[model samples]
Target chain A: MTIRLFLILGLAAGMLVADPQPQPKLLRNGLGQPPHPQAMVIEKLRRMNPEERERVLRDMPAGRRQMFERRLEQWNRLDSGQKKKLEGSLESFRTLTPEQQQTVRGLFRKFSETMPEEKRGDGRRMLARLRNMEPDERKALLSSPRAKARFSDSERDLLAEMAEKLPD
Target chain B: MSPNTMSCPLQSGNADVLLSYCAHMLDEERTELIEQHVAMCAECFALAEEQKTVWAALDGWESEPISAGFDNALFARIAAAERSSAWEQWTAPVRQWLAGDIGWKPALSVGVACLTLVVGIYLQNPARPVAATPTVEIAAQELEQAERALEDMEMLRQLEPTADEEKRL
Candidate 1:
């Protein structure tokens, strides 16, 4: 009779623990993250012996080596115009190293959680402007107090004028 | 039959004439040739059979009949719609004519009349010069005064140098 009571109690306790609330799982590398193998490899490869690292790289599958070679070839084939566009994109990536990328990602995640849908368009336009601007110009615009003061005035005037002219 | 039995019809009937006969879309000669080929060739006979099957299937498909009430319903709807639309159509032009803001003609006439009056007045009044022209002696005296003032200013400047020069000294 005592064993049956213990078993019942144990079962009740298990059921209580197993209620529908979602539990957090162990975080794994490469899960829910961008595939930036080059950065990862560089970090780890430094710890490995130079000869071992060289051997590992040399012994990489022919297909993967060919893929990397093809990527380089494709990069080389891009015209100056294409290169300039790609450089504009890469400039953003270069601004954030992996650690900064994580910080930015966390900030955006929080912002997405809190931000209203109406302000999304403003954010997109801001990002587009940042992406389009030259590096020095973007830096100056962000850093300059005068630029910040003028930005709102000019933007407001432009928006007001556009609103007046736009069709219903 | 031997391979040579497969005779080249061109050598027998002139290739161009035979080709032209074949090219004739509805000619009896082309029909006869096709019939003969179907009778003799297994491949053409099979193709004809396949085509006939397709045509037979197409011919077999019958369109579903429309409902018995369809014509009556359609006619009733069309008549009612026509009656309502007739009223709308009849009123539309009247409404437009009455409601239209046709201000341009009167506005334009007034604008033109005002413009004409202004032009006429300007044309009638030939502009005249003033009677009291400058006296030569008074003008010479004013010029002399202006020269004296300039000299005085120059003397003041010579006496007191600018702040920058004073600071340097």
Candidate 2:
């Protein structure tokens, strides 16, 4: 029975790894939203002449250039509120140690890839709630039965790590 | 019969001279020098004796004479193999598998059984929702956007020193 259970778990994990899902973004304004723009970089880049902008992008690999261009386009699309929310998140993100930043990135990727779509709203909401709570409150909410019913142990851990490192 | 003052050949990493001495291939002066060193060094003495024994055994061994038809027989066998049908070549592995010469069948059975079990469990659990590819693709794009945003912010932060200096002026 133990061996069979291990086999099942191993197979499940293998399937998740093998799935060709895209990783989640490290920083976004919210679900169904575009990435937040940094005012300084966007303004500086925007102020550059076309030739200067072209020169800056000329040396980048094609995919990197495209990604940068896509981001600039997203920046162009965002209104003030979305940009402000993202700026706040980005400020919090910048305060983390490099290792912590990497951990948050990994957790976000895991959440996006593994969590069910229906539960993702709950996951995001829980993350937002945890972000505002005191450490003890966060701990209480995470260990509560509501948290248990809604998320797996790993998902809860993902939320906790994100909250600790990227708290508002 | 003074103790040899030269470095031990093995210690000096120059065992070629010792090997040459064992094979009796060295000139008289070099052989004498090595012999003196070997006599004073037990490790070199053992190695030289082992090499000499190997040379003696190899020199005493004889090779069997080949039949004159050996080359022709080998060429004929090669031609016969080359002339065999492509179908037979392709089907050889399948034939081997059917004949139980391969070990993949059992492993494959176990893998299939495991996959079936996982799929059954997954389907039985209605709570586990599968994410569609389009959603994942969108998520990936969003991630790229986020990374780019961070990079843009970092670029601006690096330029902040210059911006701050301007503000001071």
Candidate 3:
């Protein structure tokens, strides 16, 4: 009877400590209206002269350049659903520390560089999904054998490290 | 609107006029006309104000006047650039040769092999092509030496000498 009582108490404590996954920004807040992000960027680009635009691009670091290029390539093709999903994820990403941001950026960059073209869209979608996953679910997904086999050692390690640093 | 703005006229591409107005560079007549236009148009008014601020910022910064030789210096630079460009056009091929990325090992090996082939051909006897048997050459050489010895013996007999003299000689 005492052993069962201790087990029940332990289970209750574990449940209390467990954190639920965060809702995506669009779901938590209202959907953003136009002018949409892509149009806003295109409008800003149109306003800049060649020299001014070149200077801005030159000032961006390599990681940001890759990020900008990736988003730029997707700008025209991004459906409304994908835009809403990215918007939510971007909101969560803004809350990360600079080091964490770089780690996430590098990890995504590595994933994109190594993935086959057909799988790339799914890989990007997975990254967007990560912003809303529960800590334990993220840990399970990252540590799964399939993920271990798929990503390179350095990329997997960065992800595992990211998992460890997640707030409860 | 102000009375001046009501009767004003402005045209596009008059940014230079606005700038001159901002700097008080225009004559009183033109300046007054632009000032009246600036009072009404938000865009031109903002530009004039921004250029006026630029003038204010420049007040604290002192700059030396251009030297009288500035035009001569500019002409000299253009001439020098033209001369250098002409010179570069002539030397472009030579520069390209000097900058070629040919790897040495394979190129040098081919060059050395070609040189060895040329030298080997020069040294080889055409009468006795490489395919001619070595044994045949040695046999012909020996027969020729024997024939030469026979002729020399005939010549030696012509200088006949005694055995003791031959031994002493």
Tens digit per residue, CA lDDT, model 3, A1-168: 344345445544543333222211222213545433323343344345656445545645777555554444444365566445444444455467878756655554555466566544434344334435876787677677877777656665554554444322
Tell me the spans in candidate 2 whose CA falls farther than 4 Å from its real position.
A1-38, A47-52, B1-148, B151-169
True contacts kept of each: 0.00, 0.04, 0.00
> Tens-digit lDDT track for model 2 on B1-169?
3435677778889888888899899998888888888887899989988998899899999999999999999999889879989998886765565555766656468668867766766555535445543222223344444555656344332212232343432
Every model's DockQ, to 2 decimals? Answer: 0.00, 0.03, 0.00
Clashes in model 2: which pairs? A25-B143
Please give, for residues A1-168, the per-residue lDDT of candidate 1 as tens digits.
344345445545544433332312322233355423332232233334545444544644777545543443454465555444443333344455566545444444443454355543453344344444665655655456854553454443332332222112
Q: Give the local distance difference test score of model 3.
A: 0.51
Taking the tens digit of each residue's C-alpha lDDT, what string does model 2 give over A1-168? Answer: 344446546876856644443433334444545544444445445455666667656666889778777667666676766566557656666677777767666666677688787776666667767878998999999999989988899889887886776635
Q: Write the per-residue lDDT of candidate 3 for residues B92-121, one digit (tens) a residue.
A: 543443455333455346446645554554
lDDT of 1 at A117: 58
Q: What does DockQ come to for candidate 1?
A: 0.00
Worst 10 residues of 2 chain B by lDDT: B155-164
Q: List the residue pairs that clash in candidate 3.
A: none
Best by DockQ: 2
CAPRI-style docking class of model 2 based on DockQ: incorrect
